[model samples]
Target: MANIDPIDARILARLQRRCDEPLEELGQHVGLSRNAVWRRVKALEERGVLVGRVAVVDPDAVGLGLMVFIQVRAGHHSADWLEKFRRAVRAMPEILGVYRMTGDLDYLLRARVADMADYDRLYQRLIARVDMGDVSASFVMEELKEGSALPL
Candidate 1:
């Protein structure tokens, strides 16, 4: 990966805030020419600094209003068991994210659902599918902040 200099950082900042900005507009914002900005953006992509652009969607608008974080601990932590659990979680559409952790729990899962009833059914399915000996989950009451921007 290329080291992000001041110019590169500026380009990233502008791009993060407005991905649809034209090359010339981005160049003006970053104090570079149109072609320079285009090359920098391409370089960033090549270096894997800029991954992919995506549109942020409203969960409530999509009818998946409830947010949940589920903690899971398995009966054992063998590699095969972990892989199986991961594969099982990956297949569930309701599960938005999954992370293996260093804390007491083996895995942390983020899921979205319509309501408590929906979550209950999802939880039951998870219990049936995962090789978990312990499971705990908490519902998100509020979203204080949510964003993917990283300060340069």
Candidate 2:
């Protein structure tokens, strides 16, 4: 990541809150010309600071009311096993986020489903494709906060 100055920080903060905000509005808020603001945005993108804009959708409204986190213990830690695991994850749309972490857990997956049955189906599919030592799932009853913003 590039060193972000005060101006870049302000632009990033504003963009995090609402990526779809008009360039003129962003310029007004950050005390820069629209062209200047656009330049900074483009530069940020080039530097890999600004990833990409995405629409925030309501999961519950779309029948994805259940949120489950699965902790996976890999049976084997090898390049072939890791490749198979990654491919299985990539093919599953229900699996939202996957993290390879330190500590006892080898992998963690955050997934969405309509209900337990849907989640079970996903679980069966995943395990059939990947050799996991153990898989433990936790269903979330409430989510306090969620966003893609960084504390820059």
Candidate 3:
């Protein structure tokens, strides 16, 4: 990553909160000219700091009422096993997020389903495909807060 000074951080903070803000408005917020603000945004993108803009959707409204987190312990820790597991998880639309972790678990996965029955089906499918030694999962009781916006 390139050195992100205070100005760049401020620009990114404003952009995250209001991506559709015009160049003039964004520049004003960060004390830069419209052209300068535009250049900063472009540079941020080129440096991979600003990945992409996305629409945050409501999972419950979209027929995904159940939020589940699965901690998986694989039977083997080989490159082939890891690749296969990743590809399998990526192909599943219900699997919202996946992460490799440092713990007893090899992978941590976030999935959204309709209900308990739906999650059960997903669990069976996941284990059958990946040969995980152990699978532990928990349903989210409540979501206090979740957002992509940075604290900056």
Candidate 4:
């Protein structure tokens, strides 16, 4: 990350909590003028520090309470297989996040499903498109922490 001053850090910290924080309030919090704060915010965006903001929704509220993490091991480590795997996983709306990690597991997929039946349907669709050597799944029983705050 680019080196940010104390004022910039304060701006980001507040923005992270509420991206659309009023300029006057944010300026008062960081001891700067509203226009100055606006300038700095624009500069931060230009530097790519502040990308974009979106609303955070609860999975349970959307009827996707169950969280399942699926680890995929490659059946065939080839270009065509990888491309198909990527496409298959991306097409599933239930699959919220996918990651290619540097460990034993080749890919990790985080899926938000309604229940076991929903997850099974997703699994069947996934396997029908791309092959997996080993697929392991874990259900989250509880969510202890979920936040978008980054350590500043």
Candidate 5:
């Protein structure tokens, strides 16, 4: 783990809320000069503490209002099967996240779509590409809290 001091933690907390905040403003919050903040930010990036900076888009604004959580049971557990599954999911842009899970479920996928018909299309494409023993999905009715920020 990276050595994060109190000041660094403060800076990270602020950045997680708004990364595009001006360096001068961020420095004021963390009790540092703009140059010092810039140096620390550079060090954070170099240490892989800060991997990326991106614009978070609203799914509803883009016409993708449905959020789906898909549970998958793999028919086979071979290395080749895993590779094929990875390739298939990676190729599909609608699949936002794919996780190899433990316990009864083999994998879980998160995707965004326009509606039930769009979700059906995504499901069809997924099943056609990979052999799944069982597939089930749950739609999110209401999102109480959704964010990518990590608690420091």
Candidate 6:
């Protein structure tokens, strides 16, 4: 990790909440001049502490109301199989996150879709692209909290 002082932490916290906040306002909150905050932000980006900024959109509003966690068991563990799986997931925009996991599950996929039918289509497409031993999905009932902020 890069050297992050208290001010940098505060800046990161603020940015996590609102990436588009004016530099002057952010500086006021962090007790730094605008230029100082800018430099710090630039440095943080250079150090790769700060990645890309993006807008968080509402899934329901966008007609993607269902969030599903799909568990996958690999049919066979091989470089070719892994490469195919990676390419399949990366090409699917509905698949928001794919994690290579330990324990019983080989991989876990987080996806959003309009409904069960949409999910079925995604499943079909995925299975067509790659082979799997077993697949199961669980839909989210209520989201108590979901965020991208990291504790600084």
lDDT of every model, 2 decimals: 0.89, 0.95, 0.88, 0.93, 0.94, 0.96
**Model 5 segments more than 4 A misplaced:** none
Determine which window of 10 residues in candidate 3 has minimal summed lDDT: 53-62
| Best model per lDDT | 6
Q: Where is the poorest 10-residue window by lDDT in model 1?
A: 1-10
**lDDT tens digits by residue: candidate 1, 4-48:** 899999999888877988999899878899999999999999999
Evaluate model 2: give its lDDT: 0.95
RMSD score of candidate 1 (Å): 1.7
Q: RMSD of candidate 2 to the true fold? A: 1.1
TM-score for predicted model 6 compared with the true structure: 0.97
Over all chains combined, what TM-score does candidate 5 have?
0.96
Give per-residue CA lDDT, model 3, range 68-124, as digits (tens): 999888878899888889888988889999998997788899999999999999988
Off by over 4 Å in 3: none
After superposition, candidate 2 runs with Cα above 4 Å error: none
- Compute each candidate's TM-score over C-alphas: 0.92, 0.96, 0.90, 0.90, 0.96, 0.97
Question: Model 3 residue 75 lDDT?
Answer: 73
| Total clashing pairs for each candidate | 0, 0, 0, 0, 0, 0
lDDT of 2 by residue, 1-152 (tens): 25999999999999999999999999999999999999999999999988898888899999999999999999899999999999999999999999999999999999999999999999999999998999999999999998888888
Between prediction 1 and prediction 5, the one with superior lDDT is 5
Model 4, 43-124: lDDT tens digits are: 9999898898878788899999999999999989999999999899989999989999898999999999999999999999
lDDT of 6 at 130: 94
Question: Which candidate number would show the highest TM-score if scored against the true structure?
Answer: 6
Candidate 5 structure lDDT: 0.94
Rank by lDDT (best first)? 6, 2, 5, 4, 1, 3
